[model samples]
Target: MPSSTSTSVSSFSHHFYTLLLLSVLLVAFFPGAFHYLSSLPFAYLSAASSPSSTHQPSSDQGPTTTATNTMSWFQKQFSLPPRSRGSYLVTDHVASAVPEIAQYKVGLLNLFVQHTSCALSLNENWDDDVRADMSDALDRIAPEAGPKGQELYRHSAEGADDMPAHIKSALIGASITIPIKDGKLATGTWQGIWYLEFRQVKHTRKVVATIQGEKA
Candidate 1:
């Protein structure tokens, strides 16, 4: 009986030492792999519990976010009466033309001029001298005639001021973007939209306005 017990104890000790050595080798050579294997059970538990434990809907309000917050767009085209070559304030004209703008709460207004010889800009609205001064400055930059009263450009198919008008139109932009809030333009107190006409003769211009925002 004593000899049988001693043999069984020796076999068990040999198996225990083999398993311990294998575990130590794995820990020393593949630490990351061991860690990932150890975390698999926890990850499985989390995934299994998430569906029932985390995403419980409330009794009152369901998913109402996308339905309530929707966006809309509006567009309009209007014409400006023929006027002499100069800078003219046209804020009120735009507002009157696009009455649909009042239906928006927060949005953007983009005013684009269809003609190439004319431009749109924002500048001082309260003073008339500013307009005259701006026109004078632009004229000096791109004059129609030289000092000897001679034409300076080659493209004069329209008139003496045709090339100069094109230059001015390129310098100043043909489009202006303004913020719309509470159904009105959010320009500063002294700021207004300017339609710069560079032609020598009075010409009618077309403007297209677009609005994008949420309704009030």
Candidate 2:
């Protein structure tokens, strides 16, 4: 009996020494093992204390109810339309339009013009001279009725301004995207949105402005 007990003790000692040597070898091979093992106790404690696991919903309760509850907290959506002709400052109009489309603060402001002849751009709106200078510059670059104008463009079924307008639209572009923050369009202090009307005749112009952001 004494011999058997000694054998059992020697076997346990050998196994313990082998396990210790293996652990040391693993730690030496992988330095991060110690950090990972050290964190296990804290992770176990955190899992034990987490409220979500403690308050799990019953299986009979449908997930749809929770989803519905979450969806009900969302803010309402909104949309606004504004039209302009000739030259106009649309900053105030944009500011006023946001209240109708979305109750939350604006994240992104997208201004798009439907007509190819008309377009949107950002420039100084404080002085009339700025606008006049822009108009004059455009005229200098692409005149309304001239030799270059007549030779380069032939699709003038809509009269002289038609082709010129198309040229100007191509030079400038038809859409502008602006950022919105705190219920206002976030443009530079000197910058303002401009609606460039290329046609000589009076025509109603439509501008579609969209605001996207999370609700307050």
Candidate 3:
């Protein structure tokens, strides 16, 4: 009976050792097995406890700031009417007339007349009738040709048109400065700028448009 009891206890001890050895052998051969088993739960716990990662823009990435820094100063010039006229119209097409000029985002525009008789003004360009009316009005104010100061007034040095041209220039003006925004003339919706050529004969009138702003 004592022998049988001892044998049973020894067998049980042997079985326990075998099970422990199998467990260690499995862990040693499949090294990543334990790691894989714990990975899912570990990942869940880590994600729950930690803050989420996200992307953010720096100062350089900001649109307005980038635009401001990228902007550059620029200038340009254009001619209008091609010839002297009694009535004329100015349009925004003038902006595109010079493709190179349009590349700059103009902030300030200065319009200059090369000739003394010619001048600049802002008016409606949409309607031809308006231009005709303006011409008629100017004609009424200063008639084309007639005697100056009765029959004999001294100063008539540079032809009849010369003095009259000077007078017309005085009545109208020479140069005008216009504010530009987003690379465009900032004239009112109904307003347009013009170069008034007072000469009767077709003259090469210049419209010097100077623009200052950012480059493309």
| Highest TM-score model number | 1
Candidate 3 has an lDDT of: 0.68
- Candidate 1, lDDT over the whole model: 0.92
Tens digit of per-residue lDDT, candidate 3, span 46-161:
99888555444667987433234354544455566565556566555456654445565656667777778767888886887887787678766766555554423244576555
Which window of 10 residues has the lowest lDDT sum in candidate 1? 61-70
Candidate 1 TM-score to native:
0.71
Query: Candidate 2, clashing residue pairs?
Result: 78-101, 79-101
Best by lDDT: 1
* Local distance difference test scores for all models: 0.92, 0.68, 0.68
All models, RMSD in angstroms: 8.8, 10.7, 20.5
Q: List the residue pairs that clash in candidate 3.
A: 72-214
Cα-based lDDT at residue 7, candidate 2: 97
- TM-score, ranked from best to worst: 1, 2, 3
Report the Cα lDDT for residue 132, model 1: 95
True-structure lDDT of candidate 2: 0.68
